[model samples]
Target: MTDGPATRYARAARTWAPIDWWKLEARAVYERPELRRALAPFAPVEAWRDLAKDVATAWGILLTLSHIAALTLPVLAGGMLLGWLFQRDDLAPVGLTGLLAGIGAVLAGIGLVTEAREPTGTDPRIGRLIGGLHLVPSTLGLLVATLAISLGSADAPLGVVAFIVDVGVGIAYFVLNRGPADSGSDRGRRNLARLERALGELPPTDRARMEADAREAIDVLELRDLVGADDAARAREQRLGLLAMEMAPRTDLATQRR
Candidate 1:
């Protein structure tokens, strides 16, 4: 049976499953002086950029929780204090309101964390739902706290300013936690481009063999329907081929020209 482009590519992709493409890309980056110079300004000095991504995700979750606590804790404590000090019959209402607001803030924080952790191919509707929940509840809780403070305090102007600042911070946090909507495939294509450029500078025969290997990888990745199939694979293969080619002695004098 003759394999179609998709099938062929799939088989090719399977051949290199054990290899670490990121590590390979890193090596390529180091080998090509020109690429190193070009990328030096933008690329960080960290061992792995993926580590930074993971850390950022962790920080997002932590920060969301922190914001929730910061916004709700004072209100809860104040409710308890008012109940103790005034012995007001309305203390029950005050405490209940504070407790509900705190709970909502917690839920919002969780939603934001979930949205941040969700993988690239997560359902768009689900993501939007989580993101909306994350934003809405926290906003509502902030508004409630602001109103309550304004009503209870003699310093109305100060209370109003505090409310505005609280709302502003919540809005900023929502914006900060908003995850990028691009698919994993888009990211992969960009990485492939960098790999390709690195491969292009290697010796000719090494470049050719790497090109072949990369084609196999692309076939497996089904990068064509994603399109740029051949080019992506060739670029990766050429980069890999350079290492293999370096170990073997060259036979062709004509190889020096191109």
Candidate 2:
């Protein structure tokens, strides 16, 4: 929820001609004060910074589909597999009246995980205790759902429901996951292009000054020479480029803190 360099990039991306602004680096080299000051006349930097916190909270709460699916799909699929493997013809049709109670259980586990990690610290000890308590029911819900389906009690009910849930979860997963995965390198190039275009329209003097300031700032802030480029530290800053905002919420916690 804190307003750091990541927050600035995320918000600035939205205003910068609908590009995948999240591609902007959180490091000071990309978030240099001089570059920001140069662009401030074109943006509501303060207002966006204030909204950055809420936006980040919203992101953690709504993590697109990839992260959720990683944890949920396996459980749901395992439930279906168990149900199919153990189904009985003797089960009542009335039990088939509806078919989705099982789907809700997956939410229980992850929801508890979110609140514990939520950014609040008024009472650390109490928070930790309460957070752990949430897991009891979280585990219970999944356990019960698993048992019900696999034992044939919820098979008829969840027979088709499993497919629905998995497909829905699958489609959501794929759509959300569809984006550049590199550490914004590609996006960084695109952003650089956009910035270049903007600068192109400016007078030579102002453009020179702004570029000079940004270059100097990057020179000072850059750690490229300071640190070795191993080519495999492995960081991925998330989401589709142009269409990212359409499918996923802009307030991504993972990205906002990048």
Candidate 3:
């Protein structure tokens, strides 16, 4: 029999993707203690491998959103205008591809915003599962752009580059949301070796900043200190808080919830 999807997806998630400029950009979000201090966990740099994946996952969010805006506005407004002015209903939607792109772009924006919101709830695992679902249309417009390019083939120069970036992001989300079974309890503790490698790749100051962020994320979110807390209740607060930070981001929930 063929390998199960879990086995396969876990393998694919482990596979090093062909393009990774996004990982660098995501990591840069943590370059300074000033920036790190402002993060969801007070310093979410402490989360485990999956949350680590969250680091890589945010790369194309802004670019993808901007890319969709660039493509959609021109085609949507221009196409409608051309269709109306020339009295050719036939011109509307370029036979429906433009319409699909427009719809997908709007839905994709909503999905991406959901993906960006940090989880705030009694159980973060549930929030992560929901937030992960949002990554789809979050990346949908880019996929539509890829499809639009494939269907049109005339916009090759920029479209080709977007196609590659889209593929890289696809790889990222697959790894992030579809990996092997996870309790997500291992946020900071689950993937120590990989985190170490990532840490090793950083400059000395950047590495120092991560350490600082871990300490700060707890305070920023009003979580008790996990290691130093004297009792179970405080440690539970830290545990839940880190899980909440790892799961999602949106609308400065980071500042308001705490």
Candidate 4:
């Protein structure tokens, strides 16, 4: 007999009604040697494993670039203004410093935009590089401004005040934009938790992939009952049903109420 929509629907309904059906399918996919071998070619073990890591890395890079750009613009602008105010006979060095810093800031802004568009990854090394880049420029700008105030033959108190303001602004920018570092274990745990939540929201037929992801996540979290107990399972199924109902073509609810 040909399998039609009715047969598929019946199978889905039966599968959805029992958690054991889902669990058995999951076990079969992993434990059955023939099924595993047949599925090996289509499995995206690396891509699925690396998805969270990529996202975290991308976020870290974007934030770092943004924070650096914020600090860079103000420092460059203020430095140029200060240099203009002090217009000594030798304006070359100060002018060049301001110009170079301004260019660097613009380049950093471009980098930020590019990084924002790129896909994220979960590499700690990449995150560290991004984080370091964010802090390095601002720190250097602060130091340079401080040195200029101390060494320059300008209005001493005014120079000091400007330097302090510039440093303060940079510090504030860093504080506001900095994101937490991604530890390898923590990233894995968070990704797993997210996968579990996503799996819990899917219908039985549509949930096979999500269930696999949830299993991987559970393994990462070392949780025995990531999907919880009978009550939790029922609640999850109800939630999925409600979601499906909402997605279905709408009829007049008022007529039904009557």
- For model 2, residues 105-165, the per-residue Cα lDDT tens digits are 2442343344333322112233233323323322333454555666665535444443344
Give model 3 RMSD, 1 decimal: 17.0
Best-fitting candidate, measured by TM-score? 4
How many angstroms is residue 100 displaced in model 2 relative to the true structure, after the best TM-score fit?
A: 8.6
In terms of TM-score, how similar is model 2 to the real structure? Answer: 0.29
User: Which is better, 2 or 4, measured by TM-score?
Assistant: 4
Please state the error at residue 209 of candidate 3 in Å: 8.3
Residue 111 lDDT, candidate 2, scale 0-100:
37
Ten residues in a row with the worst lDDT in model 1?
249-258
Ordering by TM-score:
4, 1, 2, 3
- Candidate 1 regions exceeding 4 Å error are 1-15, 27-134, 153-163, 169-180, 183-233, 236-258
Better of 1 and 4 by lDDT: 1
By the lDDT metric, which is better: model 1 or model 3?
A: 1
Query: Local distance difference test, per candidate?
Result: 0.39, 0.33, 0.34, 0.37
Better of 2 and 3 by lDDT: 3
Order the candidates by lDDT, highest first.
1, 4, 3, 2
User: Lowest-lDDT window of 10 residues in candidate 4?
Assistant: 249-258
Winner on lDDT between 1 and 2 is 1
Better of 3 and 4 by lDDT: 4
Alpha-carbon TM-score of each model against the true structure: 0.30, 0.29, 0.26, 0.32
> In angstroms, how far off is 200's CA in candidate 2?
14
lDDT of 3 by residue, 72-185 (tens): 443453344344334633222332433443443454444434444422111234333333333333244344444444555323324333323333443443443443222233
